[model samples]
Target: MSEVKLVLSYKETIQSKLDERTKELIIHAKNASQNAHAPYSSFHVGAALLLSDGEIVAGANQENAAYPSGLCAERVALFKFGFDKRDRYLVKAAVAVPQIKGENLVPPCGACLQVFAEYRAMQSTPIEIVLVNGSGKVLIAPDIYTFLPFAFTNRSFKYFI
Candidate 1:
């Protein structure tokens, strides 16, 4: 039997050496964390999306009593971008989560990754992702697939073609 392997790619960079635009996006995400409504988990999370038009949209996690009714910070930002500017492409995304002492970096959920994959498939371009730790360290992935190896993409339905 033959075996197939999936590989994930990412880059870890110092915050000071990051490009100006990346730094800006991370900053927005960090600030957005302050607006998170996570009374249950007390884990505030924020996400920022950079559109092709140079506009940055940010979102904070909003928790609800029903639990599942609430959405993640990444989804909130992505949905806002999709609704407001359906024609534009999402160039990059950054996430920031606050820890008890400081803060931590977390990856997007599976649902969010699926949504991102759809958008990336439509654009035929890569979407950069920035993950920042509580100490402000940054990890950069060139595309969503890096965070979701063996992901389900639109191409998976090619049988219909």
Candidate 2:
């Protein structure tokens, strides 16, 4: 028997190569990073979501001294979006980390990836993901599947349900 392999595709470019809307979204994420309260790690992150209604919601990381209690910027933005406007689906999302000297790209954590997968399932649409690195480089994925191809969905528990 032969094993099957999956390959995902994404686009990589400089921030200047992106369109106006995407640039604006990244900017929102960058601006949101300024509000992050990361007293311990000093590594701030921000996320911006573009809703179906053309609204942009941004959130920053809030670190806590109590270790695991801290939530990622992606989740912060996602939870707020889910709570405030359940009716509007997410069209796109951008995650930005603080600008540094090199081309350092920080992808979302596993927990944040799971949350994104859940939101993608609920929306039934592809949410474009824009990841901006510290050096103005960008990565664009058509959907969450590019990052988490085997993400757990409700179907995984079909037998129990």
Best by lDDT: 2
Q: Clash number for every model? A: 2, 0
- Tens digit of lDDT per residue, candidate 1, span 21-128? 998998999899999989998888889999999999999999999979999999899889888988789999999874623344578989999988988888989999
Clashing pairs in 1: 99-103, 103-134
- 68-132 in candidate 2: lDDT tens per residue? 89899999999999899899999999999966536668888899999999999888899899999
**For this target, which candidate reaches the highest TM-score against the unseen true structure?**
2
Candidate 1 runs further than 4 Å off? 100-104
TM-score quality measure for candidate 1: 0.92
